[model samples]
Target: MPVLLGGDANVYGMARSFFEAYGVHSVAVCKKALPALAHSRLVKTAVEHPRLEEDAVFTAVLQSLAKAHPDKTCLLVSCADGYTMQLARCREALAPYYRFACPAPEIVQSLGTKEGFAEVCAAHGLRTPQSVALPCGAPLPELPFGWPVIAKPADSPAYWNCRFPGKRKVYLANSAAELEEILAATAQGGYRGAMLLQEYIPGPNTALGVVNAYCARDGSVPWIVQGQVLLQERTPEGVGNYGAILTEPARQDTALLTALADLLRQSGWRGYANFDLKYTSGGEPVLFEMNPRQGRASYFCTAAGANLARPLVEDLVQQAAVTLPVLRPSVWYTAPWGVVRRFCPDKHLLGRAASLRRRGCGTCHLLAPGEGPARRAWYWLRQGAYWRKVFANG
Candidate 1:
């Protein structure tokens, strides 16, 4: 049994990956019930534990679940940064019963914070955006990189918990006044953490790329996956979510893969890690950030015929030699047709998306035979309304 933590589209994608790779149903655990997650045929059970913030409560919940299923081998996987840290903090206590994949608590805390990640990049002499940290209640420093900078939370999960209108994952400030305005708005929005002012890598959206690797404890990576971001959400709240992704075998570069793999190896990282990068005008890819777990866009890797979950399952459960096949060219588009048609600005990308659709490309939502009638009905009803809103707004 694989227990997935987090109930967004990313968790849904993981459930699908595990099911497709191992022919086993995985359980999804979330703080609240997500209708889309409940509709997934791949989820065997949906567990809701609302008080996960409390360590004792979280431990009890996991203890009870593990106690109930004594015979089954369960592997715990956390997709969200908060839960990853939670598990990492308590892994020592839970090691006797429940098995999970994550780095140490310190490692989790270090990589999850933007400031810590920047330090890691500097240690490796890796290329990353020039950035300045704006601490809470401090006077804004002189802009080092100039106008049109990107402002974002130093700690993403903590920042996201704050609620306010016009709050975005990444804020673009084209002028000094706009930068001050956004900073004031964010402070009013209740985000007390430091804000990162970064030099905006100039280019179209196509310059963004996501790369991943599954590292073993001994610093060996059996495989890697990379995806080119074609389309992503443009809304304030939905800013960083990828809506379309593509991967190809020929596109893999040894140097790029090694650089990312070395980051994992040096950090003693074990399990799935996804990196976000943007290319400079001269074609050099600079690291933007790293997600400690499998990213929402990980389904693109699975679509490319390299399911990342397979390696984890094999190494942890099956205890077998994990040989893998080469990744083939594939694409995944999660945006609704209405949203794509209305908001996607690139007509060339639209043409390519259409071509991929015509060729029967892989997708995140796979409503197939044997799916429960209620689940299927819920999927259609929810997705229809979602598309309707997207179309209306677009």
Candidate 2:
């Protein structure tokens, strides 16, 4: 019997590492067209609908996998919210055919939405940024806090919009007027979802991003790993642009991470998830946000030491008891060449290329040498061309 891992291709790095570590064969189902650089032999299947319609697509995909591999143990690990929620909803029908690594539908829903999760965090005394939600069409909330506050849609479009090819917008406002202006622009642009206006927490040069793995049945926190802060950059709108540099564990940060882990255990969250956080001036760690699915940094964790995906697969397929690894402090960096091209388009291409050459960080580009240079070149060229158009208009 074989194991099938299905979800967005964004998780290919982690998924691939896990499959290899466990010596298991699997397939990846991407919501969009298959990437040209994917492993030659990894089965690639395309969904009928885009990411927002992942629920419908995944239900169909699961049915197909079940029919195609009835003799095998199919483990569905959703790396996107739409797929996660959809899988939970169809748990009854799919459970009889395949194993799923997710919490119950109600539990997932409770943690999926910002409002719902915020309420839970408040009740549990977790430290989250000060937040105020405004009704649609209403004036923005009074700015009780000062400048450089972060504002974003409380409900991320990961489920509703997926990753559309465009200049994504997430805002950081230094004044109430700025916040109001951005909200107005967003409303005018037809965004009607609930949004959060939060106090932005600044920290030292180094901060930790914690990824925890837990057991769903007893809410047992099994693994807590901390990734070193390499470099963090944000768009003008305050959305995270690049995360580079992952290093060995920081003990102080891990204690704070463990505290949050205890909270998740009490809340009955299971399977896999991550929390983004920063330490305050007083050295208190404050919560930034929670990802109810596989964190984008999963690859960094796998590359650094522990393979998160392996346990997830084992838990789903064999209900196996697993222990986590004592991962050494290691360094990870996003592909410098890609980051420069992604964020610094105003500079000359030659200058950007030079800057990347000087950067010292882990290189994990979707397209790198010995893998598929031609395909990587094509994808970046397309991305560069798209950005060129935006800058030309500006």
Candidate 3:
């Protein structure tokens, strides 16, 4: 059985993937039971611990859980960045119990942040936006670029735990004053990590793209899936979160896929990787950042024929050969049709979502066919509430 870390959509999505590929009920461990995993029948167990974020607490809890399931081969995967870092750090101790693959600690530290990602891209000869890292609470350095730059946390894990008024995942500053104001507020809110100032790649929400790849031991990619983001979360903290994605054969770019694969091989990296990028007017994708773990919407790749759990179980547990196919057309949705229709800012992409919906191509990460009346009702209510939440916040 797989022991998933986190209670959000990533945990539930991976839990569902495990159950779908194998009939095993995966155990989910989170600080609190979020809606996605609360009433799901797929999860065999949900462990809630207050101190899971602490490195010592995380190591102790997972070690104990591994001991409990000694006879069974337990595979541990974390959805949150902090948890993923802990897993990599405690890999020596956890290795005896779990069967999983992750990047080295130094690699996780080097490639985990926006600043590090830019450096990595430079090493690999990949195109990325011009960026500068600003130390929090310090005078702004003279940027080689002009105003209308992008402002965001260079370290996501540190930023995730911080709560402050007017906090957003990313900020588009129109001038030096706006950028400085953002820096002041972020520092005042207790965010001490490096804040990045980048050249803004302007585009509609639909112009964003994502690439999900699973790298095997020999630096071979078992499968890679790329999709165009149709809509994104407008809420402050959820700003960068994708709400809908479109994957079709017509839009596939072979060169882009090869370039990313080369980066993985050159970096000597393994395990799942998720990348976010945006296209310039020249139609070139500018690398934004890389999430080390399978993203929260990892199921997006699963929908395009890359089952997240199957590869791990086959490669690690079954010790059998695995083959794959290229991705195909499909739509991945985090909410219901009603929610997407109402909240999607671009009407052109909204129409495509509608078309995909009619053909039964849309998949909801949180919705499953096995839910009973009450749980099912709760699921709909939870997703439907996004309409109110977005508008209210606006």
Candidate 4:
């Protein structure tokens, strides 16, 4: 069974994915009981603890859980950055009992930060948003980019550790004073890492591209999927999370796909890796960042007929050769149709979404087989709440 970390839509999606493949339930360790995991048949165990992100507490929970269930092989999977880093750091201690699907500790430290990822992309031929990484608590340096730049902490886990009056996952600074204000607030929150000030590419959410790939034990990335986000979560906390994807290869930037595959192959990265990118007006895809594990919306790959659960099981559990096809032309929905329509104003994609559903090429992560009444209600309620949040923000 996969011992997943963090309780959210992504973890539930992963549990459902594992259940669909092996007809077995998985375990989850989260800080709170989120709606997605409530009354779900797929999640056999949901462990909640406040200090789950702390190093000692994280290891103890898994080690205790492993001792409790020695009959089954426990695979450690992370759905959040803190868990992913902690799992990679504590791999040696947990190797005896639990199996891991994460990269090495060094790789996690090297590429986990935005500046570190920018360095890797620069070494390769990948295009990224032209900006600078300025050290926090220092005098704000002259930015290479213009006034309207994207700002966020270079490190995710570090940023999550601190609290402030108004802390966002990302910020768009339309002026120099706004940039200074964001940086000041971040430094005041006790984040000592560098801040990522990147060029803000202009486009609707539809211009964003998402990639999901899995590299096996051997240095081979057999499975890959590139998707164009049709609808995105518009709230501050949920920004950059893809709610609907249109996996039409014609619209996706293939060069980004090739560069990413090469990055995984040459870097010797194993397990699932997902990339977030935005397309420039010149039609080039600029990479935003990378997740060491599969992203929150990875179920889109499963919906596109390229199930992500099979490859990991084949390579790790079965020790068999793994090969799979890419995603076909389809619209994968993880949100309700009303929510997707409410957030996405593009007439072209709205029409495409409608036509695709009529022809039966549309697939939903929540609408899969075997969902119970409670989960069914949570799905709609969660989407409704998300819709209201976005509406209020506007």
Checking candidate 3 for backbone clashes, the offending pairs are none
lDDT of 2 by residue, 1-394 (tens): 2333334334555445645576555565545534432442333343434543545655676677678876667666666666667667877777777766677888887876666777777887878888888765777656677779887777664413433332244577887787777777666656777778888887532554555455554567776676644444432321363345454554436667667777778778877777777777677777766667766555666655677666665566556766675675444444344543454433443243344345643445244334355556765674575445445544
Root-mean-square deviation (CA) per prediction: 2.3, 5.3, 2.0, 2.3
Q: Cα lDDT of all candidates, in order?
A: 0.78, 0.59, 0.80, 0.81
Residue pairs in steric clash, candidate 2?
A: 170-237, 171-237, 245-332, 245-333, 246-332, 247-330, 248-329, 248-330
Q: Which of candidates 1 and 2 is the stronger one according to TM-score?
A: 1
Q: Where does candidate 1 stray beyond 4 Å? A: 341-353, 366-370, 377-394
Give the Cα-based TM-score of candidate 3 against the true structure.
0.93
| Model 3, runs deviating above 4 Å | 342-349
Residue 172 Cα positional deviation in candidate 1, in Å, after optimal superposition: 1.5
Task: Please report how far candidate 2 places residue 260 from its true position, in Å.
Answer: 1.9
Model 1, position 122, has a per-residue lDDT of 83
Off by over 4 Å in 2: 1-9, 23-26, 33-43, 50-57, 158-169, 233-238, 250-252, 337-370, 376-394
RMSD of 1: 2.3
lDDT score, candidate 3, position 249: 70
Q: Could you give candidate 1's per-residue lDDT for residues 318-344 as a string of tens digits?
A: 766565647876767676555665656
Which candidate should be chosen as best, given TM-score against the real structure? Answer: 3
Clashing pairs in 4: none
TM-score of 4: 0.92
